[model samples]
Target: MDSTEVVVRSVRTVGPDTVALILESPPEFDARPGQFLQVAGEVDGEEIARHYTLSSPGADETFEMTVGIDPDGDLSPWLGEREQGDTLEVAGPFGRSYYEDEPRVVVLAGGPGVGPAVGIAERAMADGGEAVVVYRDDEPAHEDRLRGLEAAGATVLVTDEPLADSDDALDVLSEATGQVFVYGFADFLDDANDALAATGHDPDDAKVENFG
Candidate 1:
């Protein structure tokens, strides 16, 4: 939608390649899970705006995003350079937040894809939903955050590499009776969506987000 100025509030590392950013937005604006805001900054006289999904759950004027830093990645490095109090123009806490007050949920996150899924899970658990987080490469990707989920009463299922064929993942995913959310890179989109399909879940009951 529209853009607003936000100030950098903090930064923390979430994974080997992922950085979690905390931003202070206008008190009148509240951001939701799965929504991303475009943060724009000037790099060497050129302006760059990067869309980052909120990683931590918050309200009352704070927001977060877990961004993968590629050494050569333009938008990422620019975002990494921002510091506390630095102002950024952010627009549209955009994207349809894959969230509901449902009572049960299965969150499938692959790679740095845990960003949005973790955000979704946090909210679900707080609302008393039975939740599970299935992450690839486990602690290496989640570290203390996964522990936070466990503490919040979520069952975490982890798998390393060769991330089971789509079918195999589905076999494991079919156990959840409520909604399913699959979060991954762009390449995993269709396969994961199909996996949910094979489980007999309604396409509308499944939510998929691609971090390209």
Candidate 2:
């Protein structure tokens, strides 16, 4: 756990169900894409831990995480209540970074899943690889941030494609040559795999990251 204590610099609402948790990074913090922070705090007399995807691109000094509101959730509520100048504990950069310099990869994300996708795309962009991203039902506040993500050279697609009755996300995802990286609802992975396998897409190429 390459952990540190971060001071809460600001908190901004990104959508009805999401908020951007901005923190002042510790000195000499260097985190790669796909890594996460396990924030530990007390909520309602329980030892609570929530893993948040960092949104601060590159090795920036300001660490930020995109959090979705869970009405029945224990941690996000407390996290949402945090004001500027507060402090939070985080430990991480504790996983594999998104593939760098890989062939054309399809980034499939839903809601908060976009952060890691963008991080991966950023890494690919840095390595000069072709990357495409697809988002489903993005947070309203994040629309502006996401719409221009692809305009900076990467291809980004946003769709209302149903993960159930429609295979649109699947079709768009398969258009990429090499790989598909997906993150979001558990059922999304199942539906994606089912669609891919049914359509004869190579299941080996796409990697699924399910966080349940």
Candidate 3:
């Protein structure tokens, strides 16, 4: 992976236990929606690396990553404490699943998985394609951005319950014909896959990105 030094421009809270890190865009640093960066910084005199999905579309001159801080984790706590002007090493625009010029897309996300799912929806809308984002969270993160996506011709569904329980799940899948993206923890992914199967769509056909 190619490494670049980037200076943190700002760090702001996006939701409870979540933050958006705005960093100076490195030269030629272009990443697709759903791709991640291997970010490294020194913590307690030891270098630690963590992968964070790029939450911003590639159109921006700055790089934005929305991170969910884990209080018990070594890297996340340090990342949450990062301030403006701090320098961190970043590498790769890695990941296979991303937005394309498909006619229709279904993005299913849970919890912090909203980061890349929203990014894909934004890019899809910008490309004049239809995007349906079905997000499951009690306290939805990136509510503002999701609303913006709705205003931009993307369908946004927020459910406080499981995706299978959502009344619109099967209807949404029926309309989705192109690519399907699913992001969440392992169990959430499994549930989503089961939901997809129940809707008569092949679960294996969807691109999945799993988290902890």
Highest-scoring model, lDDT: 3
Question: What root-mean-square deviation over C-alphas does model 3 reach?
Answer: 1.6
Model 3, span 1-212: residue lDDT tens: 59989999999998889998988888877788888889998889999998888887663578788888889987988989999999889998888877766667889998888998888888888787889898888878888899999888887888877777666876776666668899888878987887788777888888888886
TM-score sort, best first: 3, 1, 2
Better of 2 and 3 by TM-score: 3
User: After aligning candidate 3 to the native by TM-score, how far in Å is the CA of 111 from where it should be?
Assistant: 1.2
The models' CA-based lDDT, in order, is 0.73, 0.71, 0.84
Residues 115-162 of candidate 2: C-alpha lDDT, one tens digit per residue? 777777766776767778777763433665566566667777776565
Model 2: lDDT to the true structure: 0.71
CA RMSD for every model? 2.4, 2.6, 1.6
Ordered by lDDT, highest first, the candidates read: 3, 1, 2
1-212, model 1: which lDDT tens digit per residue? 47878788998777887788888867567677767778787888998887777776565678787878889988888777777888788887777746766688787777766887788788888887877777765445556877888987887766664334544456666776767877778656555566566777665666777778
Residue clash pairs of candidate 1? none
28: Cα error in model 3, Å: 1.7
The candidate that achieves the highest TM-score relative to the unseen native structure: 3
Lowest-sum lDDT 10-residue window in model 2: 138-147
Stretches off by above 4 angstroms in model 3 are none
* TM-score for each model: 0.87, 0.84, 0.93
